[model samples]
Each structure stands twice: as C-alpha cells, then as structure tokens.
Target: MMKMMRVAVFVFLFLGVAAGAARAGWDPKDDEKAQQAVDYIKKNAPALDRFFVHAYGFAVFPDIYKGGLFLLGGAHGQGYVYELNTLVGESTVTQVNVGPQLGGQSFSEIIFFKSKADLDNFKKGNFELTAQATAILIKSGMATNTDYSNGVAVFALPKAGLMADLTVGGQKFSYRSR
Candidate 1:
C-alpha cells in the first residue's frame, strides 16, 4: 500500500505540472484573441492615442459567465494582448477561488499602448504581469480615464448587461499600441 501511494503521488504531481505547462505554453488562439481585443482600443482610439503611441502597454479581460442559463455572468479566466496582428502580450490570469459572486458573470477590459518603447517591452515576449498594474471590470462606457503618469491605461466597457465594478475584478495591467 505504501508503494502504491507513492506511485500515485508521483503521477499526480507529474500531471499537475504538465497541465500548468500546457496552459502557459504560447497558445495559437491567443493571437486571435489578442487582435479581437484590439477592437476596444480602436473604438476608443482618440482617447487611447493621447495615452500612448508608436509602442505602449495595454491589457484586456473578457466576460466570464458562471450561473444559470438566463443569469449567465462572471469574470473568470486569463486575457491576452496583440499588436499589428502579433501575439506579443499576456495578462496576469487571475482565478477567483472563492467569492460571493461564485456563480457566473460577464465582463471585459482593455489597456492601450501609445509609445514604441513601451510597446517594444510588451512584445519582448518575456515580461510578466506586475503587481502594481491595475485592472478594472467595466460595465459600459465609451471611454474612461487612463492616467498616463502611471505608464499604464485601464479601461472597462460592457458588451451587454449590468454588473458592479467590484465584482468586475478591478485589476490593472499594461499593453502596447498598434
């Protein structure tokens, strides 16, 4: 029984590691998802341009639903970034282990880039999400305030439906411009 337990433990550990590696691995759709997110930036380009240009930082969060058929909504999963149709960015994927809104919800977020230097940093393909980065869950809006002094821009908008900003995972991340 002892030997059997040891074997099971080893197998579990191996599989767990392998799973994490697979998810972290560069995903093909990641590029497409990143481009899709660019739409938000284009919509708010005037305001976004003032924030960053040539190369800058941006971040995005999409709707994550987790509830009944009619009440579907929740913010769960990771978001990626793209520039000039390239997969050159990643978000600090957050997993809400436990919370009051444990069911399902829908939300989305976007970060913009304005300078070549900052955008280059994002396309570097090795940078990770920073603790100071801010991410706000948006419900609806044409544009929001992106304090450039902080070297980051976080915007939130709703595709549809209503939600609270708190439950929206008010997180902050960076992204580059097109």
Candidate 2:
C-alpha cells in the first residue's frame, strides 16, 4: 500500500510539472505561430494536402513534450482545431503511462477527423486515443499512402530529443471554443 501511494504521488507530481511546461510554451491565441506550424507540416509533407482538403476537421499540436522516469511517464501539448479551414477551437493533449520507461522527447502531432461525427466526438470535452491508435511518422511520401483508420488519421514529426522508453499510455484531450 505504501508503494502504491508513492507511485500515485509521483504520477501526480509528474503530470503537474508536465502540464505547467505545456502551458508555458503554448498560447492558444497565437495564430501566427500556429500558422507557421501548419506551414511547416505542409511544406515537409505535401502529401497531407489531401487530408487538409478532405478532412471534416483537424487538430495540430505545434509541440509535445514527453518524458518518463522508471515506472511513470507523462506528455502534454496545446493545439488548435479547425473545421473546413475555419478555426473552431483550442485543445490540449495530456497523456500518462505506467511501465518500464525513461527519458524525454518532443514532437509535433496532427490528427485528421474524417467525418463530422469524429470531430464532434473530439469537441465533446472528453476524448481519448485508445492504446491501439498509432501515429505515422511524417516523411516526404508517408502521408501520400496513409489512410484514415477508425475515422481518424494521425501524423507525428519529431522536433528534437532522444528517449528510450517502453510505456503504455493513451492520449486524452480537452477542447474550448476560440
């Protein structure tokens, strides 16, 4: 029981620190930086144009910080969600995992909602990525052949960092109107 309590405290503290870090770097109202991020993704993976043109909505997180120590891990990031080229809201992603894991890394992630239902589910305030969901690493031709799985498609671009972690976690999100 004492060990479990210590683990709980560690997880809470880790998540609090990660949340603060995420908030420090994210400004939901910063449209200029958001656009730059979008541009970067588009420039690096032109194949994603099809998703931008066809997806009912999408969310882009300019940067995500993930780190783990021993049996605890956490990640956090803020993003903008758009529907049909119009900004609909701002969203935050948070993830926590428990397993044999360690190290830290940063990456950019984007999720494309293939239909209104999927977007609606995301905007409903409590949405999560199941363990089965996986993101494709962005590359020159990767997106060209990528297809949506279960009404959504995800792409990730590593910014910088190195980490060796074996963890199991699901990403959860909260949304707010812009």
- For this target, which candidate reaches the highest TM-score against the unseen true structure? 2
The digit string of per-residue lDDT tens for model 1 on 1-178 reads: 5675466446535643553343445667767766666665456444555543533555555543322221112233456664543555565433222122323345565555555555565455433334345444443333546464344465545455543323222322233323
RMSD of 2: 3.5
What TM-score should be assigned to candidate 1? 0.48
Candidate 1, superposed: residue stretches over 4 Å from native: 1-21, 44-46, 52-55, 64-74, 82-86, 95-104, 113-145, 161-178
RMSD of each candidate? 8.7, 3.5
Clashing pairs in 2: none
lDDT by residue for model 2 over 43-140, one digit each (tens)? 87888999999999999998999887777777888888888878777788888777877688999999999998999998996568866786788866
lDDT of 1: 0.46
Give RMSD (Å) of candidate 1 vs. truth.
Answer: 8.7
Point out where model 2 deviates above 4 Å: 1-29, 140-143
Which 10-residue window in model 1 sums to the lowest lDDT?
65-74
